[model samples]
Target: MGAATFNRRSFLKGALMAGAGVASGAMLSGCAPQSASDAAGSGSDGAAPMTADAYEKLTWSFEVPPEPVDESQITQTIADDFIVIGSGVSGLVAAASILGHGGSCTLFSAGTKAVSRGGSNHAVGTKTQKRLGLDYTPDTVAAHFNNEIARQGYRMDSRKWWKWINQSGEAMDWITDIMDKAGYTTTLELPFKDPNGTFSIPGGAHNFYGPEIQNSANDGEPLLTATLEQYILDNGGSITYNTKAEYLIRENDNTGRVSAVVATNADGDYVKYEGAKGIIMATGDFSGNPDMMAKYCSAFADYVADGAGDYDAEFQFGGLMPGDGQKMGLWVGAAWQNTTPSAPMIGWYGFPAPCSDQNHPGILLNVEGERFINEDTSSVYAGYAVSGQTEKKVFAVWDSDFAYRFDTWEALGNNMDNLGITPVTADEKAAEFEAGVEEKTYVKGETIDEVLQALAEQGGIDVEAAKATIIRYNDDVAAGNDTQYHKCKEYLIPIEKGPFYGQYNQLGPAQFLCVLGGLRTSPDCEVLDEANKPIEGLYNVGSMMGDTFGTFYNFRVPGQNLGMTCITFPYVLGKQLTGN
Candidate 1:
C-alpha cells in the first residue's frame, strides 16, 4: 500500500477543476517523521483487520491494485480516529479541523511538507467580506449562482452548489480566523469584468498575506496547506509524510464502513493505518495520470501539458496531478461522478494585450491575420476560442485610445464595481501598455501599417488580410455595428489612431491548469457509490469530490474549488465526524 497507484491499478477518477491555475501539490517525496522512519513509517506491525469485499464484481484496478502486499509486508498498524490520504489543502484542512475539534487525525501524504497552488479563495458572505465592506447578500449571491449554472447548461446539482454558497463564507471565515491569528492579511484579487456584462461575482475572495505567505506576481504560495499542516502537527494530530495511500479497507465487503487504509512509506514498507471513525481522500486531480486523463477527459488528454508522462517517478510538483485518490476510491465501491467529459481549469494568458486575459472586447486575429471569435466574451471563453485557433495563437489589436474607450480597465481579481476594490485609472492602463512596449510584447506604431509591420516581427501575421480586416472593422465601428460576430457595440473601438498597439499571444489546449470533479460526493463530503448511497466512513474533499462545477473554470469566482471543495466540505466533514 503506497501512493494510490490508481494511475496504474488506480482505476477511474473524475474530478474536473474550472480555474486555470493548478497547484502541482506533490508533497516532499520520501520525507517522513522520525517515528515513522523508525517504525518503518506509519506504525509498528499488523495489517488492518476488516470484513470481506462486498462488491466483488466491481473492477478493482485499471492495471492492478498491485495484488495487496503480503500480510507480512505490513510491518505495523497505526490506529487513529481519522486517517487522511493526502497532505494537500483539503487533507491538511480536514486534519486541522478534526484536531481543532479535539479529535485525533493521522495524515499520510505522498509528498514532502504541505503545499498548494494559487491564492484566490472565493467565499460569499464572511467576516472578511464584511471587513472589506463588500458584503453581498444571499439573494445577490443566489442570482449570481443561477447565472453561473445556466451558462454550464444547468448540469450542476443545486445541492452541491448550495452547499458551497450557503457554507463557503463560513468556511472562509473558519480558515480566516486561523490565518488572522497567525499574523496574516487579506485582500481582493483584481476583478476582470466580463465584457458582455453577462455575469459578475464578489471579487473579495480571501487573499492570504503576511511575511510567511510567499506570493509572486503571477502565482502565490498562500502557505495555506503548510499552515494547516503545522496546526495539525502542533495540536497532536499525527502525520506521516512520503507515504502514499495504496487502497482502502472496507468492512462487510462494500456494505460496511471504510475501516482502514494501507499505505506504503518512503522506505517501501507497507503500513496499515486504521481510522476507527473514518478515512478521507484528499488527493488532488487526475491530470497527471494519462489513463485517467484518457478515460475522464478524453478530448483534452493529449493537451494536458508535458509532465504527465513522468507523474509518479519524477513528479513535477505544482504541475503534475496524480489521481491516486479517485482511482483508489473506485476500487472500494466508490463511483465516479455522472458528469461526462469533465471540465478542465484552462486559461489564455494575454500578456501584450494590456487587458484582462479573460475579458477581451477588441479585435482579435490569428497568425494568418484572420479575424476569429466574437471577441466580446469573458477571458475564459476568449481563451477557449483561441485554444482552437491555428497553432493555438491570437493577436489583440488596439489603439493608444484604448484607455479612453472604457471608463475603467479590467484588473486581476479586484472588481471596480465592488465597494472595496480600487478602480483602475486610465493612466494606470496607459502605463501598462507602455510597459508592454518596453518589453517588446506590445509593438508601438506611428500608423496602423507600422503597427502591423511591428506585429509581423513579433509573430508572423498575414498583413494583407489583417489590413483589410482592420478596414472592415473600422467601417463596422463607424456604423456602430459588428457585421461578423456582432460583438458589443460599446467596446467596438475603431483601431484608426497612430501609436496603435497590438499583442501577440499564444494559447492552446496546453494551458490546462486544473481538472475539476471526480467522485460522487455528498454535501457532507461523503463519497457515494453508483447506487447513490453514501460509502460509510469514506469521504472526499478538494478536486477528489465531484459535481461541484459545470464548465470552464474561471477566475470569475476566483478560488471556487479551493474555497468550496478544499475548505467548505472539509469543515463540514470534520465537524460532523467529531461534533466539533
Candidate 2:
C-alpha cells in the first residue's frame, strides 16, 4: 500500500533491480529518465563528492545538480547582512534573534506563512523548569543521555549534544520571554515516569496552550512561529513570502564561499538573494521528493508512483518536504551525515492510549494474532517494534481493569506532570473508555468471548488465536514472570476481567510521520563539507540539521529535534553572529 516496506531487503532489491533506480537512466514506471551526466562531482556549479571516483551511477538527485541559474535569468535581487531560508521554527528564530540583536536579516518562506506542525520543545535547566522546580541538571540528565547514546550504539553525532544540554536553558528562556509577553502560558508536559526504567524521560517538554494561546489562529508551535515572525518584523527584519529557493551560488565553484542563493519568485522570474554575512539553509526534510527518499532514506520513493505526498502537501500530515536546502547544500559540496540511510522522525504508533503513550503497555498482536514486544517500552520504540511486523501494523488488546493495576498510568498522553494539569483518575479513565466505545475508536464487550468476537468482526483478527494469547498472557501474569518478552512483572496485568477492548491499527497516514536529516551539519550550525570543513557562509537548522541523530527520534529528550536544530542551534547562532 506504500513505499515497499523500505527495510534493508527492499532497498537493496530495488537498487539492484532498477539498476541505479532512476539514477543514471530511465526509472521504473512513473519515473522520468535522466542522463549519467547528472552524476554529481567536483565541477563548475556542482557539489564536491565524498568519494574520489563517483561516476558509475547515482540516484535521481545525485545524478546531477540542476545547472546553476544563469545570471541573465535574474530579474530582481535583494541584499541583506544575513539571509534565513525556509521560514519554519528555525528560520523564524534565527531571523528574529539576528534582528532582535540589532543585526540585519531577510527571511524567506516558500510557504505563504511560517510552517510548524509540531509542539513541545525539550530543554534542560530552563526558566520554566527552574520556576516549576523540576530538576534537570547535568547530573540528573547524564544517566538518561548516556542511555540514549547507548541505544544509538554509542554514536553521538557531535559534541552538540553537550551544547544542547548546557545552553538549552537560556535558549528556551528566550522563547519563554516572547511567549510571556504574548500573555500565553508556557506549560511543561507532565513527564512520563518509568519506575522500572523504561528508558527514563523525565520532564522538559514545554508546550503552549491557554486562553491567550487559543486566541491565535495557530496554537502551540504555530503560535510561537507567528510570534517570532512578528518579532522579526517589529525589529525591522524583512521576510519574503512565496519565494522558492533553488540553488546556491558558490564562488570559484565548490571551493569558494557560498555568497548567495537564487530562487524563483511568485511571478515566475529568477530572483537572487545575497547575504553579506551568511546564508542559512533552514529548508527542511525531503520526504516529498521520491528520488531523494530512495537515494537517502532508501524508503518511500515508489510512493510517488502510488500518488502519495506531493510538494504542495509538504506541511500537512503524511506530507513530505522537498529537502530544497539539503539538495542545494549537496550540490555545493556539503556532505551527508555519517549515519547511513538517514532516519525519519516518524511516529509509527497505532494509537495513543490514555495515561500512556501510543502502543500502550498492553497485548499487541500481529495480523496472525500473536504477541510481539515486551509491551512496556516507550512510544517510539514500541512504534519501531510494530513497524517490523507483518503489513507493518498490529492490534492492541486490553481489559477494563487495566487502570487499577498501575498506581499511575504513563502521563505522556495525559501530560500528568503539567503544572496546570488535572490528573486523569482511574474512574475518569474508565468512563472515558466507555465514551470511546460509543465513538467506535474502541470496541468493548462484556466478556472475553464477546470481546474476541468484536475484535474479529471489527478488526478481522483470528478470534481463537486471540483467546489463546489472552489465556497465555493471564497465565504469565499469575506466575508473576513473563516467559515471552519479559515485560515488567507488575505491569503484567491479566486480561480475564471484562469488559475487554480491542483497538485495531493498520499502517496509515498517522503511522508514518516526518523524516529527519539530510545535510551533515557542524555543531556551530554550519553546513560542513565532505572534508570535514565548514562551508563558509553556509549554515543549516531544523530538519536540515543532520549527524546528531541515529536510528530514530527517541523522545528520550522530548522534542529534541526542535529543541536542538530548530531552537537552540539557530538561537545560539543568531547571538553568535551578532556577537551577543
Candidate 3:
C-alpha cells in the first residue's frame, strides 16, 4: 500500500474524531527501553505540558537502547551489499534499483508487510506530458517553487530543489518502464485547473493502475508495494517482514559513517545486517508520535487539539509510522531540519465550490454566509483560509444552474480524483442533490427566499444576514465586478437563480495524506550531519528525507511530494550508491 491508499479510503467513511487523544508510542520489544514518558516534554505521568510555549522547546531526542544486544542472544545475522530500512516506496524502489544493477539488497519493514501507499507521481516533462500537450515548463515550475518558498516563509535547498525537478522526467520514465514490465500501466490522474488553465504540467500526477496486492494473513495489502516488492525479490533481493530497524550502527572511527543497522526481528530477538555500500532510511514522517508532533508540529497539533479536527484521522487506519527512521538518524547526530513542522497535504474532502473559476473557482463562505476569500484559489490557500476561520467550517454554495453552467464531467465529475470527493457525473450530481434534499447533505429550495430559510434553519445561518449577503453578491454580478473579493467575473454566478444548494465543508483538521519536514538531506538524499557534511554511507529517502520543501507541502503541483521522496530521490540515491 502506498501512502495515499489509506487516506482515500478513510476519508470516504467520514469518521470524525474530536480533540486529540493521548499520543501513544508504538509498543515494541528489544528495540529500546520503554519509558513511562516519551522525551517530547512528557513527565513520568506520560502527559504533555499544559502550556504551548513549554511544549515548543521540548527536546525530541531519541532514547537509545541501554545496552547492545548480547552476542549469545543474537538471532540470524544477514549480510547484504546495501541495507534499506523501511519497505515503503522509497526503500522498495531503492532496493529494486540496486538489485536491478546486480547489487545485493535486503529490505526491512516495521510492519507485517507493506502498507499505507499512494499512487501518484509528479513529473516535469515526460513522453506522456508531451503527448498530452501540457504547457507546464521547467522554468515555470522553478518560478512556482521560488514563489512558494517565499510565501510559506520556509527555506529549501535551492540546489536540491533544482536538481530533483531537473531529473524528475527521467525518473518517471525509469519507474514507469519497470512498472509497465511488471503488468502495471501508469495513468494520468486528473489535474487541477488554475484561474488560467490546468495547474499540472499536462500529464502530472501519474498513478499506477494495476492489480491490487493480495491481502496479508496478518494485515495490510501490498497494493502498489507488491509490484516493487516482487521486482526486488525477482532480482535476487530479500525482504524481511515484521522487523523494526532499531538503530543505525555507526563506525567507531571519526569518519561519521553508519556502517550497519541493528533491527528487532519478529521473534523479539535482535539481528544485525551489515551493508557493504550504504543504508537508506525510507521510514515515513513522525505524525504517529504525539510527542514529536507536539514539539515540532505543535501549531497544527494544538489546532486539532482545540477542536479543529482530528489531524491524525488520516493515519488512524494504517501503520503507525512512529518516526523510527527519524529517531535513529537523530541518535547518530544527524541535524533535524530547520524548517516549519511537517505540514499536511490536505484535500477538499468534498468541499463544494461557490463560484466558477478556471482554477479552483468555488464560492467559499464562512459559517456566517459571508465570502471570506476569492473562490478561485489553490487548494493550499483554501485549506489555510478555512482553518483560520472562526469555526473552521465553510460552505460551498451553488445553485441547480451550476450543473448546466459548467462542464459537469470536468468540474464535479472528476472532483474526487482531482483531489478528494466522490467522483460526480452530471447525472450523479443531480441525483445526489435530490437525495441530499431528503438526506440534507444538500439543502434545496425552489426560490431564493426558500433556500435562505432552509439554510437559516438547518445550517445555523441567520436568515436576514444570509439574504443580505446573497443580494449584495447578485448586485456585484450584475455590475460586472466583484468589489469585495475581486473574484473573476466569469465565476460570479449569482445566487439569484432558483433551486439553490449548499453543503457543509470543513478545511482544517482536514486529514492530510502525509506530513513533510524530517531529517535534512542533500539533493542525492544523503543525510547531513550537524556540521553540514554528508554522513558517509548513510542516505534517507521518502518522507523521512527533508530540505526540499518549506512550511507547507506544495499542493500547487500534485504528487510532487511523492515524486521527489518516493521516486526521483530514491532512484538518484540508488544509482549513486551502486555506481551506475
lDDT of each: 0.69, 0.72, 0.63
lDDT of 2 by residue, 356-428 (tens): 3434766888777899888777777777776677776577777878866655444432342343335567777
lDDT of 2 at 175: 94
Error of 2 at 2 (Å): 8.8
lDDT of 2 at 462: 81
Candidate RMSDs in Å, in order, are 11.1, 5.8, 7.9
Q: Taking the tens digit of each residue's C-alpha lDDT, what string does model 1 give over 482-525?
A: 99989887678788877888878776434667678888888888
- Give the range where candidate 3 is weakest over 10 consecutive residues by summed lDDT: 213-222
Every model's TM-score: 0.82, 0.88, 0.80
The candidate with the higher lDDT, 1 or 3, is: 1
Best by TM-score: 2
Residue pairs of candidate 2 with colliding backbone atoms? 38-63, 38-64, 39-63, 190-417
lDDT of 3 by residue, 178-264 (tens): 777877655555555445442322346666554342211111113346778888888899998888888777877435688888888
